[model samples]
Target: MQKNSGKSVLLLFILLIVSTLSAGCTDNSSTSQTIQTSEETSTRTLTDALGRTVEIPESVDYVICSGVGSLRYLTYLEAQDKIIGVERSETTNSASNAKPYSLANPQFSTDYPVFGETRGMDDPEKILSLDPLPEVIIKTYSATGFDPVELQEKTGIPVVIVNTGDLADNKEDLYESLRIIGEVVGKEERAEEVISFFDENIADLKERIADIPEEDKPTCYVGGIGRAGGPQGFQSTEPTYPPFLFTNAINVAYGDMDINVADVSKEKIIEWDPEIIFLDLNTIECGEDRSGLRLLQNDESYRQLQAVQSGNVYGVLPFNQYATNFGSVLADSYFAGKTLYPDKFEDVDLENKTIEIYTFLVCKGDEELGREIYNTMINVYGTPAFAKLDI
Candidate 1:
């Protein structure tokens, strides 16, 4: 009986030891799993518009956009809520500040902080000083002198490069840039919507004008197109202007020029002698000194042109402020179509069409807000004095 009792005691002791060891192993395994989960949730990799593979946070909550159109693209994605800072140009209030993105996002100027110089200059000090250090910095390809890899290394933040295409020619770059931004911001669906909206509008415009014969297309010239604030007279023009291109109008400014906006001699203007003239209202808004409309109105040389004498001259909203106001570009195209080929665009309503384009792009489809923006562009502020002509 004594031997049997001792055997039972030994067996119980061994069982207790085994139970403790199992518990310890379970705790260690649980700790390892927790550490792995934390690492997985910490960071993710993405390819930016510049094709640089960057590791960003798994969830990007705060950001700063540099360059001319970085913030504008963000606005299109409806991720403006993530922006922690803006460029200096966004803070300034002006009638000429016709960027629909800015008009749609009023809080950017009133609430958010401005960082560094305009057009995406490197101000690492200011960026670091932000209250909540931005997790990422977005920049446009146009932001010169700032290298993305160097900037990322200096700030220890992921820098994503984006391209803001001219919208006239390099539209594919713009679409790709939007997709990259959507991936980074986790708004892929909204980005697709924006791209679709632009594509549909452009396609519709083209389809409407496609059947028109080349000989029937009106010869057109757009002048006083603003570029980096300078001496803009009647000769400043966009060679590949969006309005003329989309409407299928003949742009007499078209030539083998290396730049979009360039100066043409008054003699060249008289030589081409386009039937219709669209004055960019920006030159007049810049004040009397830079007013190309004023030159066209007062100059006897301009009076000799057929478009001027026959009252075919019209005013178009400035679409080139701080980059391109894409909404204005589309709106200008419709207006140009209506004016140049009135019978073709007879079914189109300018006010309703402008509202539709603006609603799709900005202000969340608010027709009233669309009208306000449109009025600011064509009627209220930027309209040239000569636009009152009886054409």
Candidate 2:
């Protein structure tokens, strides 16, 4: 009976040992699975602000700017090296910054040579004719009928829609747009630099104007005086346009002024009779040198206005830097301060400020030219318009 009991105990011990080995193997297998899951999640792809799911590529090299001015930011960030192609307009001699650079250095725009204008984003056939595919397409939009989603569906390439509404409203949108583009193009650091420069300059301009009293703030007006392509000179009196919004100054014609931009009649302008006139260089008078602004200043009907007498009128030419020209917001602010208390900003230097904005937007740093554009007009229209409008 004792020998049989001892044998049973030894059998029980062997069974226990086998059970322990099996449990250990199961635990190790589970740990291995958890580690594999973590690795996969780390590399997982995500969607961007434009609502497109983009996988972070091992490296992003080739790029194409789908809409106008998209390439300007890319070039500003120094990421032009990664661009494979750009719209024909972007490569044109008329495009200012990009054109001169592209001409001097063939390599400037030739990384990938794309032919055709910037207006054909929806033309898949034209895009396809380019043959080689771009990994990404960046575009801008307003109320236009061309749907970005449809374009994406037509072409296998992913389309990222950038909302340009902010260009007409606030500064936050500008920074946000930059960050989104940077992420798409893998130029995050460069984007941050551009944003920082914009923020710092804006802050400085505000600081200089803070001491002025609210009652004394200069009343201001911002708009484009001449249309470049129109058979007759064009007046962009529309309150919703870029020149008005980016300037951040009060538009005399915006709220109760009853001005019609589409009709673009000088009769409409005479009724508004804004104290401070801001001219867009592309206006009908573009090639006429200061002719557009001069016409408005010398027009017999406008001679009685305080602005024409005091020299408060100014003109800003549209280009990559001023093309979007958020700096005009600061220009508006500085001009307002000077009008309110000429003594305070006497040393503030509007000319220098103009240069700073141009420099920030493009490497050309045309400070003198910026001052020249403003002075040529401001001298003609006097300061009363700038003074009468509360900025």
Q: For every candidate structure, what is the RMSD over all alpha carbons to the true structure, in angstroms?
A: 4.3, 10.4
Tens-digit per-residue lDDT, 143-197, candidate 1: 4847777888888889988898866789988998889889888989998999998
Q: How do all models score by TM-score?
A: 0.87, 0.65
> Candidate 1: deviation at residue 73, Å?
1.1
Lowest-sum lDDT 10-residue window in model 1: 382-391
- After superposing candidate 1 on the true structure, give the runs of residues whose Cα lies further than 4 Å from its correct spot: 1-41, 142-145, 256-260, 380-391
Model 1 residue-pair collision total: 0
| Candidate 1: clashing pairs of residues | none
Q: Against the true structure, candidate 2 has what lDDT? A: 0.53
Task: Give the per-residue lDDT digits (tens) of candidate 2, residues 36-145.
Answer: 88764543244555666655443456566665446655665556666656666554443233222232235544455563355544466555555456666666652343
Model 2 scores worst on lDDT over the 10 consecutive residues at 382-391
